[model samples]
Target chain A: MTTTTAHMSTNAATLSTPSDREIRVERIFNAPRERVWKAMNDPALIAQWWGRGNKLVVEKHEPVRGGHWRYVEHANGEQHGFEGRYAEVTPPERVVRTFEWDGMPGHVILETATLEDLGDGRTKLVSVSLFMTTADRDGMLHSGMEGGMNESYRALDKVLASMK
Target chain B: MVHYSTSLDSSFAALADPVRRDVLVRLARRDASISDLAGAFEMTLTGMKKHVQVLEDAGLVTTEKVGRVRWCRLGPRRLEKENEWIAKYQSMLEARYDRLGEFLERTRGEHP
Candidate 1:
């Protein structure tokens, strides 16, 4: 494994309808649906990539209906925590959960992820987040979380490119 | 932390309805009065006024009262913040998905 880089680039195409009730993000991965689902559900694998290269530690990951999960990310000597509960979970296909950033308690979002099998060992992932109010949905959009993630991706891309 | 201005929420809510969105598109191209909007949409004057009120509350439209006539125009830079906010998230999601792809590629042999 290459050392994680200090900067990251972003190329994610996230979209939120003007409805203010939901935000949908879609992407295609060069892996089978089952593999993509497993990578998302498995705590061990999640820890490796969930934090955008930050030192992520999974405390619990129960990818089953009514189950709960928690993970912490250590960045620059500070630990950030996130936790959520599963609303629905169907292996290799779909999972719905409630996500909340511990730093901003009470601001919870219902997130649903669906994996679609594309022939040739590929899969398309669609994740949608629903908020209680337009304000909450807009809040997440304006949080600048996306900007930070883009930076992390750029840095990670550089590190991976160097390995090749 | 997630934080959005109250006006942002109002703006989105105002834009949610098809009629309101059309109103915005019209205003974007040119200014019009409440009666003009009503006539264009085939809506009642009262109905148009309500819609205009919603847009004005959201700062999406500016209304000026000239004598007894109120002229309406698109609010300056009204959609800028919302569009920027959406664009950032769209790109961010793309990057995250790319990482998912990388992780899958690296762990394929191990998993399967």
Candidate 2:
């Protein structure tokens, strides 16, 4: 009932849980809606940003409805694979897709992203991910605490420590 | 199945009240007696006790009577875990978005 908003930093994305089974992330990008949409759907452009500067290989990408997409990110000598199928796609407006990580194959998240034009060459992206159940949502969130891609930072820390 | 949902429902119900949520936040900083909490929040002892009771029922707070004063503190079930997870998730997204923002800046004229 109480929405928990986590603001990472100034001028960054904000994440919240609006319902028991949903996680919402809202962010503003300094670009037109069309350009943002193109970057999101284009495989090369997605690789440029989706991996947080890590090398990302877009093995397959099809933004059309019912199309399948897969991406592999290489970080800290580990590969993280993510794949999904597009349920709906409306260019420069909205997209609905199913996202499943290879580490946790059976647990899939239905994600909906909407782009709103801010009219000043900026766009607001609202992404809401719906889990099958509250437990699934909690599990996915907690799983990030351990073996998720975020662990690469810890691995990097170890590597840096050895160098010193 | 029923037990899990019931406990989760109660936790949500307990957190629904702003006062109760504030109590948890204050307790997270340090434990305090019931009277201390009531005085800090500017509420009557009876009213603060009721809020603490709700939190206790939800397993979010625990109270113990030390002599005459009843001390309250966070229970075994801490909401900090959930908050930490959300914060980490937000940071990960923010990092990727930062890169996305940079890409947009570099390719602005090309895209237009």
Candidate 3:
């Protein structure tokens, strides 16, 4: 049997003292929610900005509950492959998915994205990933992801520019 | 070579908490008796015992009995196991990025 334990969570309420480990990132995109939503969904747009500047080949993608997603991140002749099932997917608003990298054991990362429309063309995307433990959270934070994420955003900016 | 994961599910389950993390952090500096460790926590001694048991189970700390004197010291292997697991993923990411750079270089040459 699989074991899953949840903390009191650093979300809306601080009810219990269940020790929590959390990571939250917020970004505002100049495009409208509908347009931003499309970029998140369209494979063409995703390919352009996914996984830093590496080539992302979405071999299979089905964004619905119980759907499976498998993609390969290829760069410099090496590949970082990851795949998982979608637990929940709400278009233009939310997506909950399980991520696992085949190369490493215990590399499971559950991710959640919440998008809010600011009534203007601008939209905000907040991503929170709940890792297995504090060590796991720190591993990602210290893994030099800051550069990759910034690069991904620059690519996204290019995508928005093309749409304009 | 120091990677060892003793299959004490309960012990690891207990170590998976922040309160317990605080206790382990304190214990690492020096060995202490039960009462001394419990005194540092807001929880009761009885409650602290449960946490101590978890640490013992995870093999992160050991409690010794010398004429009813229960002393605990940090068990270094448990920390090693966690770090080893993290290191594996890092190597994987680095390898992947190395390949991406080569691919980009080839594309530039061909287009030029």
Standalone chain B TM-score for every prediction: 0.66, 0.68, 0.58
Candidates in descending DockQ order: 2, 1, 3
lDDT by residue (tens digit), candidate 3, A1-164: 00111221211111121224334545555556766666666776556555556678998799999999988888789997888889999988998987777665466767777779999866676766555655566777799777788999999999999999
Which residue pairs collide in model 2, if any? none
Can you list each candidate's DockQ?
Answer: 0.15, 0.19, 0.01
lDDT of 3 by residue, B1-112 (tens): 2234554455556544545665665665578887777776655778778888877766777788888777878765455544334333332332332332333333332321
Docking class of 1: incorrect
Native-to-model Cα distance after best TM-score fit, residue B61 in candidate 1, in Å: 21
Looking at candidate 1 chain B, the ten consecutive residues that score lowest on lDDT are B84-93
TM-score of each: 0.54, 0.56, 0.44
DockQ computed for model 1 against the true two-chain complex using alpha carbons: 0.15
TM-score of 3: 0.44
lDDT of 2 by residue, A54-96 (tens): 8999999888899999999899899989899999999879999
Best by TM-score: 2
TM-score of 2: 0.56
> C-alpha displacement of B25 in model 3, angstroms?
24
How does residue A44 of candidate 1 score in lDDT? 82
